[model samples]
Target: MTILTVNTKAFRPLGVGMRQMIALLGALLGVMLISPGALAGGEVRVTVQGADGAGVEHAAIVLRGPEDAWEPPSDNEATIDQIDREFVPPAISIPVNTRVLFPNQDDIRHHVYSFSSAKSFELPLYKGMPARPIRFPQPGIVTIGCNIHDWMIAHIYVVDAAIHGLTDAEGVWAAADVPAGRYRVEVWHHGLDEERQTTGEIRVEPGTEVDLEVSVEVASRPAPRRRGTVPGYR
Candidate 1:
């Protein structure tokens, strides 16, 4: 067996952008130690709710199986579009090292920046489309904002897991065809005020449905006060 050694100690902080990059490195290390062919097949369903007992949409659900559970997807480059002054989907999930496209479909210009650890970048004042896409080389939560518009914000989650999905408007999501075995699951949301997390081991067999419910307490939002430039384009 070949051994790969990584020196994370050599890396230093260059602001929040490093968060995504660092997360990517951590996830890659996890992947290297995992053997993909050792897992059995199964399915999983996930749901998220607000403190008021309402459904939360577009939240991220990540599943990390055992080293022998399943094969994880290779890190990919991803994209996020800004159209009509809004960030699309409002939230997204991607594998480490994915490149994200920031396309502007609106007539106005936008300034994109992230203060989050997973990754941070700036698409300084641009319109129509950007000259190039931003690349996320790390794994973590990236909260994107429009410098020109305070109300506009979006989140990108970089993870190193075999199965992941975003909740729809109904706050429902599923990661199907998961190999049967034990796994570590995680869920994240913008509305979650504090870090909400739960850890459990579950066994899934072919065609069996596993139901999971997660709770998150988010800071209350004041009734949509028509604020500065409405940020979330799409």
Candidate 2:
């Protein structure tokens, strides 16, 4: 039930980074509220691809069930590191209320911030771990980036539902032993426009695996973020 809003006037322009953040937030929220089905146990295997048959990576998936069927938010802690001036892993899925640590593995300091409505905060330039981890208290997409490194970006998919994950190298995402029930699946990718996509009335049953395939037409991926020496590092 917690959402954070931040001002970005002191940092980068509002036109670019916020576009993806807002798009993702809308995607997660729009589908998560759909009416859920009977709760029960099972597995779901999903595949995302382009119409041309290429696997889509970094796509997020969430299975939305009724509030009555919702489990307590998870307390597990996760970590995303800064290495080679990049956000390692780039994207991740975590249950609502999960604490996440962002440790600087690189030699120089970097500033981290997010303007997403789901969870917004800023970590000023620092070279090591912050004194405390950031907790995601709501269900939505949180896009975080470095003020010192414009090209450095990452995503945190904070979900209230029990099952969620990002697609892999082969455009595949899966979850097992979750409450077996009928759910509407929400899918989103950065490559797509602001309009998010939803596909499936998928049902997960005990001792069974449900496989889903979804396709979307998207623009080509943007150029990789830049990397270089700051002021005083060897």
Candidate 3:
């Protein structure tokens, strides 16, 4: 069992109320739930490419074993930064039940909200960090948008795989130290023509490199005539 202890004395002086205290405790629990798990696995690399054979950045990767096999989340908390009226990193992949923090670095305020079924939340217009982080208790895609700026958008991928990560600018995701066995891989992109795509079972051998490539059909995004020229872009 996981025990969450809060320093009541820490918040006592701040005049933080009961509701805020509960949110703080929930965030603490999210951290505990994602502690590293027991997995004596080998290394695995995944390469994600678009239809045109271009590196697909920010693609969510999921590798799993049998149906009964599973692993705990890899990290406790993550940040989705807001800069230049855009969501930095555009998209991110996190383990289920991860708490995310959004800090507005821009001078102007933004009202961030998401109506996705997995996690629905609205952070009223603000300029700095919110009172508490938003906790995602379910596994699914959460679409984030700014009410003030229609162009401001982002996606969060919450997965239940044994191990999960996002592809780099090179369309590559390297998963280190996974058990040497057959595992299924799944890839997701916010621009995908479909919800997501997957690869067949890949056999991982001890002391060997396993390379796999995935092709996804992502909708094309038109480029702006010039920077900060979008209708609602600042």
Q: What digit string (tens of lDDT, one per residue) describes model 3 on residues 72-149?
A: 454679899999878986888888778899999999899999998889999999998977889887887889999888
For model 2, residues 175-213, the per-residue Cα lDDT tens digits are 766676678777766565642455646665654567777
lDDT of each: 0.65, 0.72, 0.72
TM-score for candidate 1? 0.72
Ranking by lDDT: 3, 2, 1
Cα shift from native, residue 143, model 1 (Å): 0.6
**Model 2 weakest lDDT span, ten residues long:** 1-10
Positional deviation of 198 in candidate 1, in angstroms? 3.2
Query: Which is superior by lDDT, 1 or 3?
Result: 3
Q: Judging by TM-score, tell me the better candidate of 1 and 3.
A: 3
Error of 3 at 197 (Å): 2.5
**lDDT measured at residue 192 in model 1 versus the true structure, 0 to 100:** 58
Candidate 3 TM-score versus the reference: 0.75
